[model samples]
Each structure stands twice: as C-alpha cells, then as structure tokens.
Target: MTDPGLQPERTHLAWRRTALTFTVVAILAARHAADHPAALVLIAVAWLAFCGTAYTRGRTTTRPLPHLTPVVTVCSVLALAVAAVLVR
Candidate 1:
C-alpha cells in the first residue's frame, strides 16, 4: 500500500521557501531605498520579517494546510517595497 504522510510537510516547506524568497527580495528593495528616509526602508524590512514569521507559524497548523493569505501578503509587501524604492 502507498503512504501519504510526508505530503503536508513538503507543502509547508514549499510555502516557507516562498516566504523566504519574498523576504529576500524585500531586503534588496530596502537596501536599494537606502538613499531615502529611513522610515520607508525600515518598514520594508519589518514587513519582510513579519512575512517570514507568519509563514513559519503557518507551517504548524493542522489540516487544510496554510491559506493563500501569507502568499498574498508577501506579494503585496514585495510590491510595496519596490514601489517605495522607485518613488524615491
């Protein structure tokens, strides 16, 4: 008989990796925005940290796995960071 025990863990790891990727892009955006006021850059960094934390926490939830909220959040934050950098 086949088993289906490791799938959830794999899913969690995938999403966690996605979150980390967004966080990295956000960090780069923050660095690129260094010439502007510190507040924007700090906000970007903080948002990235929050995204990573949320994904890490989501990995522990039972059933249904994690929702798309974390992914959406990461995308939104990444977009905002880029926007902030470009607006300068």
Candidate 2:
C-alpha cells in the first residue's frame, strides 16, 4: 500500500507551487498589460481559461495522476501566455 501521508504531502506541495506560479504570472501579466493595453484582454481570457481548467482537473479522481499535473499545466500556460503577450 502507498503511504497516505506522502500522497497528500505531494498533492499539497504540488498545488502550493502551482498557486505560487499562477500568482507570479498574474502579476507579470498585469504589469505587461499596464504598459501595453492591447494585452489586457488576452491575458485576462487566458488566465480565466487556465484557472477553470485547473479547477476542473482538481475535481477528478484519476489514479496515478501526479499532483503536479495540473500545476505544471497551469505554469506552462502562464509562461507561454506571458511570453506571447510580452512579445506581441
């Protein structure tokens, strides 16, 4: 049997990291949008989609799904969104 404590610990740490990165992206996006108003809508839309997906994924009970799955997805989305917005 798997260690129960480890599972939750892994989940919590993974989520925490995800939340942190999300916050960072939000901040950066806000800053970029402030300087370039054109990016505002894109950033907002992308963020909303990302958060919605993350929430939906969290509600599922898929076995062996690493706690970092959603977190990584969110982080990657944020990174790409931010890069795209900044570049544009």
Candidate 3:
C-alpha cells in the first residue's frame, strides 16, 4: 500500500488560515467603521459566507482544491465595504 499524501490536509489548513485572516480583518474593519452600522454588518456577513464556503469545500472535495470564486466574492465585498468606509 502506498502512503496517502498530505496535500489535502495542507490545503484545508491553508483555507482555515485564510478564513482566520478574513475574520481578523473584518473585526478590524468593524472597529474602524464603528460609526457605520451597515458597513460593519456587510463585513461580518462576507466573513461568515467565506467561512461557510471554506467549510463546505473542505468536507466535500477530494483533490487539490483550485476554486477561486468564493475568495473573489469575499474580496470584492470586503473591498466595497472598505471603499464605503473610506468615503464616509
């Protein structure tokens, strides 16, 4: 029998780290936008969505994950939120 590779495990861990980073950034953004309720909600929602997608992908995927759609969506939303806060 051959040894199973650790790539999948590493990939999952990488996604987990990305989710964590997103969460931290969201919190910081919330602090900076404390006067803006809508921006804070949007940041929190985007972070939660990313976490859900990451969890689903980790559970269902077998091969090296290569999807970027979720990441892009989260980033775009966050960028919008940042821009809104900046303009405030």
Candidate 4:
C-alpha cells in the first residue's frame, strides 16, 4: 500500500516537474519567436510568473492556496495556446 506521508512530497515534485516543463517550453517558444520579439517577451514573462508561482506553491509547507494554483495554471495554459496560434 502507498504511504500517506508521501503524498505531499509527490504533489510537490509534480509541481516542480510542471514548472520545469513550462521553462523548457518557454525557451523553445523564445527560439521560435525571433520574428515576433514582442510576443516572445510577453510569453517569457508570463511563463516566468507562472513558473515562480508553481515552484513556490509546491515548496510551501502549509495548505495549498485556495483555488490560486489551478487558476494560474489554467490561465498560463490558455495564454500559451493563444500565443502558439498567433505566433504560427
């Protein structure tokens, strides 16, 4: 059986992974945005903000912020999707 004590650690690790993924994606997007420098700047800024939030939330020992993480995640995803379409 899984140990309950490990759940929070797993969750934190998952968030860290997510932040890492976002960072990688941001780098790729920047490389692709050479023709659209303004958009690249905006995307990089947004991704950095989201990454910071996710990383911090993951490290917190207290309860998850009420509804904040999900909202930030969703907004970041939608922003990235829109940026992808526009950049293309």
What clash pairs does model 3 have?
none
Per-residue lDDT of candidate 3, residues 1-88 (tens digit): 3226876677678778877887887777777777877776677777777787777666545643466645756574766567466638
Candidate 2 at residue 17, lDDT? 68
lDDT of 1 by residue, 1-88 (tens): 3235986577677777767776776667667676665645555655665675657555654533256565657667665656675657
Clashing pairs in 2: none
State the TM-score for model 3: 0.70
How far in Å is the alpha carbon of 69 misplaced in model 3?
3.6
Better of 2 and 3 by TM-score: 3
Off by over 4 Å in 3: 1-3, 63-68, 71-83
**Local distance difference test values of all predictions, in order:** 0.63, 0.60, 0.69, 0.78
Model 4 regions more than 4 Å off: 1-4
- For each of the candidates, give the backbone clash count: 0, 0, 0, 0
**Residue 62: error of model 2 in Å?**
3.1
- The full ranking of all candidates by lDDT, starting with the best, is 4, 3, 1, 2
For each candidate, what TM-score against the reference? 0.55, 0.52, 0.70, 0.78
The clash number for model 2 is 0
Models ranked on TM-score: 4, 3, 1, 2
- Could you say which candidate leads in lDDT? 4
Where in model 2 is the C-alpha error above 4 Å? 1-9, 63-88
